[model samples]
Target: MLTTLLYSPQDNSLIQGDDSHIAQWQQSDDAILWLNIDGELTEPLQAMLKQTFNLHQLALQDASRDRHPPKIEDFGDHTFILLRGLSADSESINCDNILLAMFISERFIITRHSARSLSIERTMAALHAGDISLATGTGALSLKISRFVVKRYHKILFDLETRLEQLESVMLTTADDKVLAEVVLYKTDLTRLRRNFHYHVELFNNLRDEPSLPFDSALAHEINDVCEHQHRAASLADLFYQVASDLIDGYISISAHRLNNIMKVLTIITAIFVPLTFIAGIYGMNFEYIPELKNPYGYFIVWGVMLCITAVLIWLFRRRKWI
Candidate 1:
């Protein structure tokens, strides 16, 4: 679907859809125009965007793809940028990439994105509510997008931290392999996201405070907030990775210790029984000359000796604390 919100200076009125609406918005001086393209563009839609904006071929390709992490391109007439907005619980949320392009002219401004993410949606609503106090022109749109993206990141960051903590708690208590595997799974997901966000760190820092980026003073503040959000997310992801590593190490160490203990007990039992087995074998031999075989009472003596030997071995084992 195609959606457009136009703030026209001619009548100080809001116009809101497609090519004709955009053309009307474009004619108005000192107005902000937002174009939201929700899905894959059909041939006609592509043709419209191409003819209307003269978008670079590479920019269109990047927009067509699932998501472009974060990058800025200089297209001479305009600067095209792809900003990645992360969703909560990627296991449940789609990793949809949002492309926000800027057409900065002296009087009119235009922004475009492939999807209506929380970032753009929230901004559109604010702008529609006629709360000029929020922001104005392209600068205001940039501010809203930045604020919304960062705010979403904050919520997701909380979730990420919670998952990390819960996994650590489970590892400390039960140390179940399944729980560990889950931790590894989430950690790996975070790893991929971290790489993506790391790219944003560079891209946003470069984007931030770019006086030439058409951000007004108020919008610059919003950009700063965005930078802070990216910083916090990156830091939390790094910490989560470290925590998962520690958990794996702890699990392995405890398992190894338990195995060692079992082996030690078994070895001590075997050592204690070796001599008794030898003594019993020697007497069991069918020899007519054996001393214990001739005497009727020899049986009791042999039994007593065996009992005494077993008791002594048990005592020694207890003394050594090897049992």
Candidate 2:
């Protein structure tokens, strides 16, 4: 789907249309154009991007792909940026689910994404509500959209931290297979998020240090703020990954300790029964006649002997603190 929003600062009017309005928007000098493309890049849409916007072929190719790492490239007249956006329906921290490709220039900004992007939706909503004024400049507009994109990570990271705390608490008493599985899943998710956030940190840092277009002081400040946000997000992801690792190690240690306690109890029981089993074995042998069979009190004597032996073993084990 293709959607266009043209905002004219002079008249404070907004025009919402499709691809057909592109020509008219291009003719106006006092308007800021925001073109959003969702889903696959069909041949006709690709042609229009090349002919109408004059986007670089290489940049278009990268945008057309299903997956690409976050990056920024300065093309003399415009800047091409590939950013990973969180999918609206994503349940985990998988950054590959949505890729947003942007071409930003002085007059217009174009965004392409393979999936429904919450960041794009939020920005569009803000634009329609008059909360965001593109009259500032397309550079500021791009930064606004980027800011929305980065905001999506905040809730996800907070939820992840909450889950880690819960799991840690649960692990204190029990480390079952299910709990272990969850820990593993979280670890994997955090790893992916860490890598994604790391790329974003680098991308924004590059944009801040060496911008493709000249940004005024305000825009430059905004870029710096976004870079700091990216850096903070990356650090949190790394920290969470480490926490997940520690959880796994703790689970292993707890499991081992439980098994050792079980084995120790079994060993103590076996030790206490060994002598009794030996005495019983001796009497059970049907030789011409065991001497004990000739006496009536032999059975009671055997019982007393076995009980005494058990008591001694128990006392010895307790004295050694082995039970």
Candidate 3:
């Protein structure tokens, strides 16, 4: 769907409209037009962007395709920026990041996204509530949106930090396969979040240096701030991954230690019984010349011998602290 918000600087008021009024507002010389498209761009919407906004066909294709990395393309008259906003819910580790495509110039701004974006929603709400004044130029508005996207990354980073903490806490007291699996998952998701921001860090730096658009010092500073935050988020992700990797190694080490202890106990028991088994095998020999078999207390004698050997082995093991 298409949502339009027109900001007239004279009255400092926003005029909201639908697709029907897009053409009328697209040509307005006095107002700054904001066109937002949610979901895949249909033919008509594509045609509108092409004819009205003069958006490049290549940029449109990139916006519609999957797995387009965050980037900025300088189209001379207008700049096309592609950004990915991370989702905060760690539970949905497999969910894809939200893709946002923006076209900005002095006169208008167009934002397109494939999926629902909380940051975009918040930006739009702020604009509609008149919380953001039109005086902050289109570049600052773009920066505001980028900042919101970075804020989402911060939320995911916080979640990652919390998850690693929980894993570390439980790792010592309760190490298990489930906990290890969770650590691995956290690392994977953290890595994904880092990768998303890594691209933005570069993209924003290049955007700030774009020669075609004269970015004000304030706007440039905000872009730099966004880049710094992205770098921070990426660094946090790496740290979390390392912690999680350590947790996995620790869990494995503990498991191996327990298994070794169990095996050691079993070996000690077998060692204690080996000598007794040897004596019993001798007594069971069917030789007619066996003198012990002829004795009346031979069975008792064998039992006494076996008990003595078992006691001696147990005592020896205890002395050596092996049991």
Candidate 4:
């Protein structure tokens, strides 16, 4: 789907419409043409974008596939940027890669996205809320949007750290695979976030040097701080994996010890019964040669012998500390 929003600086009016009717918004000095695209865009729409905005063919191709890494590029005529957005839910974490093509000139600003992202939308909201104003130009809006990306990276790290602590507590009492699964997921989420955040950090750092798109001096300081945050988050993720590996080793050692104890008990019981069963089997053999069949006290004598053997076996096992 393609929808347009025209922000008119004249009356602080917002206009919503399709392609043809949005041009009337050009009358305002602070007018912006915002195009939001969701899901799979059709061929005609792609062609329209290419013809209307003169988007590079290669950049359009990159937008079609979702795994593109986050970065920004200035093509002299327009700027092409790819960013990662949080695609999390109550169940599992997912990452959404969005392509934002910004066409900035003296008269207007046009932002095109291949998919919807909360990060982008929130920046738009901030722009509405006066965090960014039209007098500051499109450069201010771009910096605010990148700042949102940096903020979300911190959130991902915070959440991962919390889950790891919970997993560590679970490991102390019970050996479980669920905690491991959670660790695996958290690791993956952090890795994705770190890589994406790093790319943008580099992008912004490079932008800081370019005088044409001079970012606010205050935000320039934030670029370095955001880079440091990404580094810390990535380091913590590696530490979690190391801790998880050690826990797994401890669980295996415990399992082996329990098995050994069980085996020792079984061995002692089997040894005690073997001789007794042999004696009973011999006395019960075919009657032709059996003298116990004639003796009246024979049954009691055999019972006494079996009891003595059982007591001796138990005593031996206890003395050897095999129980």
Best by TM-score: 2
Candidate 3's TM-score reads: 0.87
**TM-score for model 1?**
0.82
Model 2 Cα lDDT, one tens digit per residue, 60-129? 9899998889889988888998998788886555444589998998888999999888888888888889
Which segments of candidate 3 are over 4 A away from where they belong? 20-27, 86-94, 209-214, 295-308, 311-323
Candidates 2 and 3 compared by lDDT, better number:
2
Off by over 4 Å in 4: 1-54, 74-78, 88-91, 94-115, 134-140, 150-164, 167-219, 239-257, 290-322
Q: Against the hidden reference, what TM-scores do the models get?
A: 0.82, 0.92, 0.87, 0.66
Task: Please provide, for model 4 over 1-323, each residue's C-alpha lDDT reduced to its tens digit, 9 standing for 90 to 100.
Answer: 66666666667665667775445644445576666565565567668667866667777666655667766666666666566555433222344555554544433455555556566678667756766665555555665565565566556556656766677777667767776566666556656655665666566556656523323465566455655654555565556556656666665676677778888878887898899999989987887978777899999999999999999989988898877
Clashes by residue pair, model 4: none
**Candidate order, lDDT descending:** 2, 3, 1, 4
Candidate 1 ranges beyond 4 A from true positions: 42-44, 87-116, 130-135, 209-211, 216-218, 286-289, 294-323
Clashing pairs in 1: none
Better candidate number, 3 or 4, judged by TM-score:
3
Q: How accurate is candidate 3 locally (lDDT)?
A: 0.79
Clashes of each: 0, 0, 0, 0
Cα RMSD of all models vs. native, in order, equals: 3.4, 2.1, 2.8, 5.1
Tens digit per residue, CA lDDT, model 3, 1-323 = 78887887878878788766666665667677788888887777787789987899989888886578898888877888899875434234344687888888877888988877777788888987878865687777888888888777666567767767887888878857788888888778767776887888888878767634525576767778877887887787777778878888888888888889999999988998899889988877888799888799999999999999989989999999987
Cα RMSD of predicted structure 1: 3.4
